[model samples]
Target: MNAKKEPSIWQGFKAFLMRGNVVDLAVAVVIGAAFTNIVNSVVKGLINPLVGAIGTQNLDHYSSCLSSSCKGDQGIHLMWGSVLGATLSFVITAAVVYFLMVLPMAKYLARVEARRKAREGTHEIIEVTELEVLKEIRDALIAQRGSVHDER
Candidate 1:
């Protein structure tokens, strides 16, 4: 009797963690967290101050009262400035990642692919030339044998 054994939970978990994609994703997440700090700092340190020159120091404080009298712990306050600041941060992060990481990686991969194709093309040409040379050799051998038979 043949019994198929399913992987144990721990084995399955280990396999999942050992996958290349899983490790890559984990690395990306950690890098993204660190990158977020830089982006946040840029927003807070540079953008906030430049914006603060016009109004409040912090964008989070910029809001509007939906209802009358937005007093302590009361009324509907629309925090539009916070949203703007977050949006700016997201744009900056995306631009930095795209230009620095994604674009360069894509270009490098493209170059690698082009080089691989060129190598394959050269290999194919060599193969075709070899085949042609082999055919010529076979034809010459056949001619030599025919002439020898004629002399006999």
Candidate 2:
């Protein structure tokens, strides 16, 4: 007897790539890579020089010495500069993402949610009022009818 063959892993991967979520992720990755250059430029070109312009002249490089042999010896590794650069990059990226994308998206979503809540609130009010009116009508109908004896 002949059996149907299972699809290969590569074929499955290809199908996954074709899915909307996968495609969107791929696009986002490319965009993120492109955005990296802009953020990097801001950090390197603008922030680094601004820091350098400050009294310390490369503020990142300026650090207090703390060593065993020479209690106040300057460290060979300028670790603070690297740290400052990283911090600057983090701040810039966070600011850009917040101002450019996250804040606006949040406001838009808030507006949409508020509109939905308004619609739902109106519907709920109408439903509750109708239910109350129906209850009143039902009680009137019962009152109009003579009370029946309860059969045990």
The TM-scores of all predictions, comma-separated, are: 0.85, 0.67
The list of candidate 2 runs beyond 4 A from truth reads: 1-24, 55-76, 147-152
Top model number, TM-score: 1
Question: Candidate 1 residues 14-123, lDDT tens each?
Answer: 99999999999999999999999999999989999999999987999889899988897699999999899989999999999999999999999999999999999999
lDDT for residue 5 in candidate 1, whole number 0-100: 95
- Which 10 consecutive residues of model 1 have the lowest summed lDDT? 64-73
Model 2 lDDT per residue over 2-76, tens place: 999999999999998899999889988998888889998887677767777764445456654455343334454
For all candidates in order, the CA lDDT equals 0.96, 0.79
- Clash count, predicted structure 2: 0
Evaluate model 2: give its TM-score: 0.67
Candidate 1 vs. true structure, TM-score: 0.85
Q: Which residues of candidate 1, in runs, are more than 4 Å off?
A: 68-74, 145-152
